[model samples]
Structure formats: C-alpha cells, structure tokens
Target chain A: MHRRLALATAATLCGALALTACGSSGSGSDAAGPAAGPVKLTFWSWTPNMDKVAAIWNAAHPDIQVSVQKQASGDDLVTKTITAAKAGNAPDLLQAEYQALPTLVSNDVLADIAKQTAGTKDRFAAGVWQQVTLGSDAVYAVPEDTAPLALYYRQDLFQQYGLKVPTTWAEFADAARQLKQKDPAKALTTFSANDSGLFAGLAQQAGAKWWTSSGETWKVGIDDAAGKKVADFWGGLVKEGAIDNQPMYTPAWSKALNDGSQIAWVSAVWAPGVFTSSAPDTKGKWAIAPLPQWNAGESVTGSWGGSTTGVTTGAAKAGHADAAAQFATWLNTDPEAVAALVKEAGIYPAATAAQSGGALAAAPEFFANQPDFYTQAAAIAKNTAPAAWGPNVNVAYSTFKDAFGKAAQEKGDFSAALTAMQQATVADLKKNGFKTEG
Target chain B: MSTTLTDRRRTAPAPGTTPGDAVAPPRRTAWIPTLVLLLGAVYCLIPILWVVMASTKSSGELFTTFTFAPGSGLLDNLAELSHYRDGVYWQWMANSALYAGAGALLSAALSGVTGYALAKYRFRGRTAIFNILLAGVLMPPITLAVPQYLLMAQAGLADSYWSVLLPSIVSPYGIYLARIYAAAAIPDEVVEAARVDGAKEFRLFRSVALPMMVPGLVTVFLFQFVAIWNNFLLPYIMLGDDHKFPVTVGLYSLLQQGANAPALYTLVITGALLSVIPLILLFVGLQRFWRIDLLSGAVKS
Candidate 1:
C-alpha cells in the first residue's frame, strides 16, 4: 500500500507539471517564417455572399488568394474576434462595424494599415472616411459599406391621411399626431428601444458626439444637449401616444409593417432589404426621403449600420499584412470588386463613385415604385454626420437597451435613461483602465 | 430475481393503508397535480410547436400569419436550406453528427474504464481522484471554452475537428454517473469469485462489470451526445471556418447576416426543426436500455 501511494503521488505530480508546462508554454512565439509560393489569407465577415465577392478577387489575384469565412454579425462577433486575437488565432482579415473599430483597435486585434491604404481616402465620403481613421493618422480599416439614415413612408398611406411628408422633426411630430387623430388604432412610427444603433444614429444627426478622444483621455457625451433634444423629442411623442413605443425587429413589428399598421420607418439605406422580407406585401408602396432634420433647412443625416474590412494583428505577425491590406482596399474601392460586393452582398458601397452607378443605378426591386431611390439615398449619404465611437460602445449600447427599454415601456422620462447610459458608459471606460473625462 | 422483488414492491400498498382501502377507488382524480403537469408539458412544448408551425411558412407569411397557423412553404424552405451556399447546411449537419457521435462514444469508453477502476478498486488516492472529478462535474464547460481554445491553439489544433472532440471526450458528469452505477450494480463477491477462477482483471471487467454497467453507460452516452449536439459556444469560439460549424452556429450565421440583408427566418426555423429529428430518433432508439434495471439479474438479497 505504501509503495502504491508513493507511485500515485509521483504520477499526480507529473500530470500537474505537464499541465502547467502546457499552460505556460502558450505565451510568446508569434514570429512568422518567410513565406513561399502563393500567400493564402482568410477573411471573416458576416455579409451574405461575401464568398462570391471574394471569389471574384481570387480569380483575378492568383498570387494573394483570399477566402471568406462567414460569421454571425453583431456585438458577439466583436467579442469572438477579440478572443481569437488573444489566442493569436485571428483570421487575416475581419469585417467589423464602424463603431466596433475602437474596441478592436484598443484590444490590439487590428493593425494600422495607413501606409498600405494610402491614396484610397478619397474613395469614401468625408464622414465615412473619418470613421475608419478614428480621428488618427493610422487607418485601422477600409470602409466597405455605409447605411445612411432615411425616412421610408408609405406613399398611399400618407396621401390617404392627408399628411405631408415631414422634412423637419416638428413637421414629423405634427404628422404623427395628425395620423393618430385620423386613426387611433394605427401609428405613424415607433420608438424602438431595442436597437441602440438606431438611437445612436438619431442622436448623431442631432450632432451629439457620444464618444470623442483627445490625447490619452476619452470623453463620453451620451447625455449632451443634442442627445437630450433627440431623446426628449421621441419621449414626447411616445408619451403623447402619438406613436407606438414598442420594439423593432419583433414578429409583431413585422406584422405591423406588412399590414400597414405602422406606415413609416426612420431607418437607414438597408431598410429596403429588410422590407423585402419583413414587409413583402407592401412592395413598391414605400418611398425614400431624407431623415427629417433636427432644425429646418439642415440636410444632415446619420448612418445606422456600416462595416469596414480590417487587417488583424495576427495577419501582420503571420507576414500577410500587406496582402490583407491590399485585399481590404480593393474589396472596398476597386470598381469591379465594389460592384460585385454591391451585386452579390447587397451592400451600399461607401465609395462615393460606386454608390451612384453600376449595381445601384437601378433601384432595389422592392422599391420599384421609387425610380430615383438610389439617387435620393446617395444625396442623403453625401451629408452623413460623422460618428465618434469609444472602446466601450458595447457597454453603452447594452445599457441603452436596458435603461431605455424600461423607460419606453413605461413611457417615462428618456432624458433620465440617457443620463444612465452616459454614466454607465463612463464607468465602464474607467473600469477598463481608460482615462475618462466628462 | 431483483426485478421480481421490485415488481412486488411497486404493487404493494402503503403500510398505513388497510387492504379494504387499497381496493377502494379514489373519490376523485388528482386534478391539481394533473393540471400542473399539463401546464408543464405545454410550457416545454410551446416553443417546439412554434418552430414546427413557423417552419411551414414562407418568409413573407411567417410574421403575418397567426401564431399556430401553418403555411405552404415547407418544401420551399427545405429546398432553400439544402441549396444554401451549395448545401453547406448539410455539411454543418454532418459535422454536428461527427462531433456528437464520435465524441460520445469515446467519452463513454473512457468513462467506463475510469469509473470501473474508481468504484471497484481499493488503490491509494482513489478517493482523491474521485473527489477531483466531482469538482470537475460542478464546473460548467462554457466557462472553460476560451481556455480550451488557447490550449488547442498552442497544440496547433485550434480550428481542427480534434480541438472540439478532445475537450468533449473528458466529461466529468459521465464518469460520476458511471461510478455510482458501477458500485451499485456490480457486487464485490462477483469480482472475488472471478479472481478465484483466475480471470484476469481486464477479462473480468469486460465480461462481468461492463455488461452490468450497460444501462448507465447508455444514459451517459445519450447525455453526452445531446450536450455535444446542442453545444454552441465551444465550437463557435474554437472553429473559424463556417464549414466546420454545427447547425446551431450555421443557423445563427444565416440569421445574423449583418444589417445589409434580412434575416433568413424561414431557413433557420426549418433547420431547427430538422436538427431535432436526429435527437428524437436517437432517444426513441436507445430508450429501451433505460427500462432495464441495473440489478435485474444480479445476486438476490
């Protein structure tokens, strides 16, 4: 028994030592050897048909072959990418949302590609370009697509209600009220607290820079004057019961849009794509207009969803940074690539030159009634307000969902929810060891 | 012999109740417990029913139709799912089967050996090892996904089939179950008799202990198979290639195709409805083993 105990103890110690050695040896050793023959790169993206678009490039560029690995999009993808990077197993290229750039950059998942992507800045709009640069000299990504905000309303419904298309927030409110008086059961639109991106875009159109960094300090302005104005305006509408306070993207919301219970949507360029499936019964009945302005005569709009193709730090360590950056640039700017992206992936190219012609020259099938749909979208896209993002946008966005979701359900003060969002965002930034300013 | 004893015990009435009372019919059925059970069944089945009903609807009709109403797009949805990315959905289905099927078989084999040794042996540090495994059973596998991914990365196995299979093969709960089942089902005297007969240890276990532990091992296999089949986070984090994704991750990728495209709700619902068929078939096929009591033909008291 004694001898067996000694043997067991020795075996246990050896097993424990082996485990610890395995754990410790994982650190360091990120150096890559010299490449040979053709360079193969993997790209992670959530865009549908991205592989088809990449296949176009792969056929042209035989030396630097790129493959697209599709991923589920959203905030979860950001966390997944960061985790993969920490393991030094990140893909060569990643398609990231414009807002998630700061988080990825701060995590060191993305590499600075300004040197490789030089002379491509003129390809995108100024505001769209600013997002990829993050107000820095280093460009972490190339802008692939932009979703400039617009108002999509039912032309027949508006005409029936004798309501004019709102060009300003005041007129929009009046129209909502007028529609409510005409039919109490029907709502003109809804205030959806479920989508933080929608609220952020609305606030951006009001000129609220929710996140801005200078030197080494970050500032969170989620409850600033412009933010409060936008919040209060929507709050007043929801309080008065002029519009619905329900969430979007729900089955009920889809039913409403399909059956014309809710007649208008303050959405972005991608609304047509959503309507194609969600409100298929209402095909060709919707028309696009610029998002109602905060003040009259202002032509500014905000983007809801857009993404950039960024080269990962792992790609750089793997000696494929230049090849990845070249693909990223060509994926967004090259006329052939962008057109294929538009045709196959159904993206609104951020490149100004490509946004108007080629694949987008004809309106989307769902918007066949509106012949100049892309023209109107392009005009709105030109005036997109610049957006600022911090490393903790995910935190702020979740808080927005919780705080504002409650406030909207209760028809309570949204300004208070906005304050909670700001406080939570700042606290998170500080907790993450970021220097924060009010 | 033990089955007869259990049968007699089940038929025997309560000790406090007289024979006349046992023969008497109940005044009324237990409506409250019956109602509660009905509610529970509905609660568990509503989501599954919703998936079934929703899968039949076309994309346009999915949200517009009534909740339980069936539509006419089941065949279309199936075709779309089959043709998606040139039948990548089937690839994901095959990958799920490989991960769950092979992972469960290996886990059951490993658990059988470890559990038999722990239960039947009198070796030093046996209690310590068993206790460690108990602690492991308490630890959720989701929390260890990132650590496992990192370790797999170090071994140059991160995106490979082995990365997922390796971690899944060492299920603590499976071993724990097998140990308890082994101790109760296999009597000490049987092993002593086999020893006096000069049967080797491996021969004794293979011929005697393994046969007795079949029911418990089947339970473990089913549990591990279902756990691996429904696993999302492990494979989601470990594998970067979509072709290697299970149906859960593949359906998610289809649903969340960025803000540019509408979610493929119909395809996802159809995929979900199809994915559960294998699990149901597996349960229906293996359920007979669970009906066999562990000590059915063992020594009488």
Candidate 2:
C-alpha cells in the first residue's frame, strides 16, 4: 500500500514535469508562405465557397498563384492570425467578420488595404465601409458581404389584423399594441437578450457611434441618449407585453414564427434564407420591409452580420501585399465572384455594382415573389449609420447580455444594460493599454 | 454478488429460512441497481439514437418534423456527403482512423516499455519520475496545444502528420497507468528468475513481462485511443490543411457554415453518424482480449 501511494505520488509529479520539459521542435522553421516561382499566397478563410473565388483568381493570373485553405474553425482562424501576426509569419490574406475588424486592427494584424489599393472604397456601401476604416484612408479590410436589417413579417396575419407596414418606430409601437389587442395571444415581434449583434445594429440605427478613436485615445458610448431612446421604446413595449420575449433564430422562435404567435422578425438579411430552409411551411406568407425608425420622415438602417477579406501584415514580409490586395478586391468586386458568393453561400453581396445589376437583386422565390428584398436591403446598406465595434466588444457584449437578461426578468430599464456595457468596455480598454477618454 | 451478499445478511436472522430463500426472488432491491445502470446506458445512447434518426432527414424535414422520427433521406444524404468536394468526408474519417489507431498503438507500446522499466527496475528518482507523469495527466490538453504547435512550427513539422502524431504518442496518463498496471500484473520474482536464467533485460521484458501485461496495455491503448480520437483542440491548432484534418475538425467547419445555411446541417449530422462506427467496431473487436482481473489476482498472490 505504501508502494502504491509512492507510485501514485510519483506519477502526478511526472505528469507535471512532462508538460514543462516538452518543446515544439518546429519553431525553427518559418511558415513564411513564400514561394520560389509563381508568387504563391496563402488565403485562410472559414467562408464557404471562397475556394471557387480563389480558383477564379488563380486561373486568371498565371504569374500569381492563390491557394485558399479553410481554417479548422473561425475562432481558430482568428487565434492563428493573431499568433502568426505576433510571430511575423501571418498568412497573406484572411477572413475577418466586420464586427471583429476593430480587434484585428487594434492588434496591428491587418495591412491598410486603402493605402495598398489606390481607390475603389466608394464601390462598397458606406456603413460596411465604416467597419474596415479607422480614419480616412486607413481602411484595413475590404467589404465582402453585408447583412442589412430588414423586417420580415407574417403578411397573412398583418392583413388579418388590418395592419399596414409601419414606416416609423412610433407607428411600429402602435401596430404592436393594436395587433396584440386584436388577438390577445399574438405578439407583433420578439427580442433576443443574448443577441448583442442585433442590439448593436439597432443602436447603430439610432445614430449611436459606439466607438470613437482619436490619436491613440478612444471613447465608448453604447448607452448614449439616442440609443437609450430606442431602448426605452422597446422596453416600454416589453413591459406592456406587446412583443414576445424570446431569443431569435432559436427553435422556440422558429416554432413561434411558424405558429403565428410572433408575427414578425426584424433580423439580418440572412433570416429569409434561414426561414425558408428551416420552415418551408411558411413559404408564401412572409414578406420583407425596411426597419422602422424613430423619425417618421427619415429612413435609416443598420447592419448585423458581414465579413471582409484583408491583406495581412505578413503579406509585406512575404512581398505579396499587391497580389493579396488584388485578390481581395477582385473577390469582392468582380461580378462572377460576387454572383458565386450569393448563389453558393447565400451571402447578401455588399458591393454596389453586384447588388445593382447582378442576379442577386432578382426576387427570391422563398419570399413569395417579393421583389423588394434585395433592393430594399441594398438601399438600407447604403443608409446604415456608421458604428464602430470595439476590440473589447466580446467582453462588452457579455456584460450587456447578462445585464439585459436580468433587466428582462425584473422589468427594469434596458438602457442600464448599455451603461454596464460602457463601463466594461472602458475598463477593458484601460487594461489592454489603450487610453480611454470615457 | 453484492446484492446477494446484502440479501443473505438481511435474511440470515429469519428462523427456519430454507435453501429456497436463496433461489426465490433473489433480491427485491436488485432491480434498483439494474434500473440505475439501464438509465445510465440510455442516457449515453440517446445522442447516438438522435443522430441516427437525424441522419435520415432531408433539409426540408429537419426542423419541421418531430426530431426523433426517422425520415427517408438517409441514402440521399450519404450520396450527397460522398459527393461533397469529391467525398472529403471519407478522407476525414480515414485521417481520424489513422491518427487515433496509430497514435494509440504507438503510445501503448512506448507506455509498456517505460512502464516495465519503471515498475521492475529499482532506479533512482523512480517515484519522482512517476509523480511527474501523474501531474501530466492533470494538465489540460488546451494548455499544452499552443506550445506544442509552436514547437511543431519551429521544427518545420506544423501542418504535417508528425506534429499531431508525435505529441499524441507521449501520453503521461497512459504511461502512469501502465506503470501501476505492470507493477500489479508482473511479479518481481519472475523478472529475477528470468535474469538469473541468462536472459537479457530486453529479452525478458519483451518475451515475459510483455505477455503478462497484455490486458493492462489494452486498457492503456484504449484510453489513449479515445482521448486522441475525440481531441479537437490539438489538431485544430496544429494542422491547417483541411485535407489533413480529422473528422471532428472537418465536421466542425461544416457545422459552422451550416449554422448560417441550415441546408448543410444534414451533411454534418450524417458525417457525425458515420464517424462513430469505427470506434464502436474497435471496441467490439477488442472485447475478447480483455482480462483486466488478472492484475487483481496477481497482486494478491
């Protein structure tokens, strides 16, 4: 028994030492991604169908070769890009979601694409263009796709209740109550407490520029007056039980959408595809509209989910910055590439030219022959207010999600969640060695 | 045996208790343990069952139909999965098989050799060495993966099979288990006699001690086998080439894209359903060789 105890104790120490003594033998070698003959550039992306776009570029330029490797996971890709950037051996190009643009920019992982390429920033929508830009001409990523906020509602239910589409936020509140009064079991919409992206977009629509940078100092204003106004409007509706309180895109929300208890969903452009694919039964009854706003005369919008491809700092180290930039621009702006992304990936194209005359603008059959979805989304993409996501958006989102969930249960003020978000963001910025003014 | 023991003790005080008491309704409380074990098995099998039924669904039938009700698109899903990027799913499965199968085999052998030496030989710092290995078992895989990848990168082994395979082959837990198991299973007298009879140390270990440690070594191999097979962080960090990815990473990337487009979810479900077959088959094929109780008796003797 003493021998067994000694052996057990010995094994535990051995396990700890094994970890300390082991070394990664491959640190000597450089994963520079450099090539001898054709200028080979490694493109890391989690985006499906990026290979087809790379193949097109590879087929076009014999002197320049592009190889696309799908990262094992999106989170892995981000982690790898940061690690490689620190090690000075980053990939030539990589995919970054629009929300993570600030994270990448703050890490100095991205090469300034605006300076790399002469012009063509104007080709993409302004709101999307905001994500990749720090200051004028300091754009680090090119816009690839955008998910503009669009209202999708049960048209049959709306018509049954004698409700017309609300053109503004005031009208939307009235309809939410009117529709609920017509049928006590029904709600006009639902909200997701956990979905910070949707809330970010709504805050954007309310003209809250959440992040601001000025010569190494930054300020976060997630709970600004405009944002609070919008939140209070929704919070009042929440207290009145006009809207169903449920997380969007969940199984429960899907069930609610199908059953007509929740008649409308204000979501990203991707929701139409999700609705069609997830609930084929709700095919013809759904329709799309631009998101309602506080101002009756104004038509402002917001963007939720989107992605961009950027040249990495290591591209310069490998002497392929030009090639990488060329590929990124072509992948986003080239008609064939944009068409393929739309058709294969169901991505709502961010390029103005692609959405204008390309096949993407054609009415989708899933929307019951709604011709205005692509056009309306493209228009919203242009009008979307420029809002910046901080490097600590993940932390801020969590802070807000927790507070927001609590607020919901207690019937408390929703804007206070954003105040918690602001405090967390400010503290995180200070911890990360950034000068915080607010 | 435990139930019967308790049953015998409980009824021993009853006067005129006959032999029939032993055979009649063995123990009323036997059903409790049986029911508990059956519940545990069902809990484990529920996901397997759900995936089995889910694999049979079409894209349209996925969320609309009752979740567990099997659909008719099983063959179609298989065909589609096979046709995806020229059946890359099979390559992932084959890669997982290679990583897990070969990693376990190599780890088990190394563990056996090291375990035998640590158990049989009286060397300095043996306890210290064993303790360190036990501590390694406590280290999280995620904590080690980045450093392992960086080292693999330094050696120019990143994105290669060696990076994943080499790190996996040296499982401290496996080695520790083998040491404990070998000490219990192989008697010291046997090794001493083998040495006295003019056998080399290597010859004695290979021919005598190895055969005696078969049951324990199988356990070591299987422990490493499942550990390496289901590991996501290691390969997810080390390897970049999707062609080199195991089924877990492949299905993960597929599932990520599937989150946006629910149509690809069927492919993910089907791939998952098919990936578990090899491990199940492995367990069944190796069941006959298990004689782990030999160590318990050998230790007492």
Best by DockQ: 1
What residue runs in model 2 are displaced by over 4 Å at the alpha carbon?
A1-27, A31-35, A72-76, A409-411, B1-29, B258-263, B291-301
User: Candidate 1 on B1-301: residue-level lDDT in tens?
Assistant: 3353455345554545444444445557779977887898899999999999999999988999888999999999999999999999999999999999999998888788777777887776788887888888899989989888888787667887887887888788888778778888899999999989998777898998999989889988988999999999999998999999988899999989989898999999999999999999999999666534443422332
DockQ list for all candidates? 0.44, 0.35
In order, candidate lDDTs are 0.89, 0.77
**lDDT by residue for model 2 over B1-301, one digit each (tens)?**
3344344545564646754564455546669878888898899989899999989998777766788899989999999999987788899888998999899998898788778767877756777777767777798877988787766666667778877888888888778778887888788899889989988766888899999989888988887888888999888877777889999988888866522454468899999889888888878888655444433433554
Please provide, for model 2 over A192-269, each residue's C-alpha lDDT reduced to its tens digit, 9 standing for 90 to 100: 787788888888898887878877788888778977887788788888888876667666666677777888878877
Position B202, candidate 1: lDDT: 74
Candidate 2's TM-score reads 0.90
**Clash number by candidate, in order:** 0, 33
Q: Which residue pairs in candidate 1 have backbone atoms (N, alpha carbon, C) closer than 3 angstroms, thus clashing?
A: none
Cα deviation at A278, candidate 2, in Å, is: 1.7
Per TM-score, the best of the predicted structures is 1
Worst 10 residues of 1 chain B by lDDT: B292-301
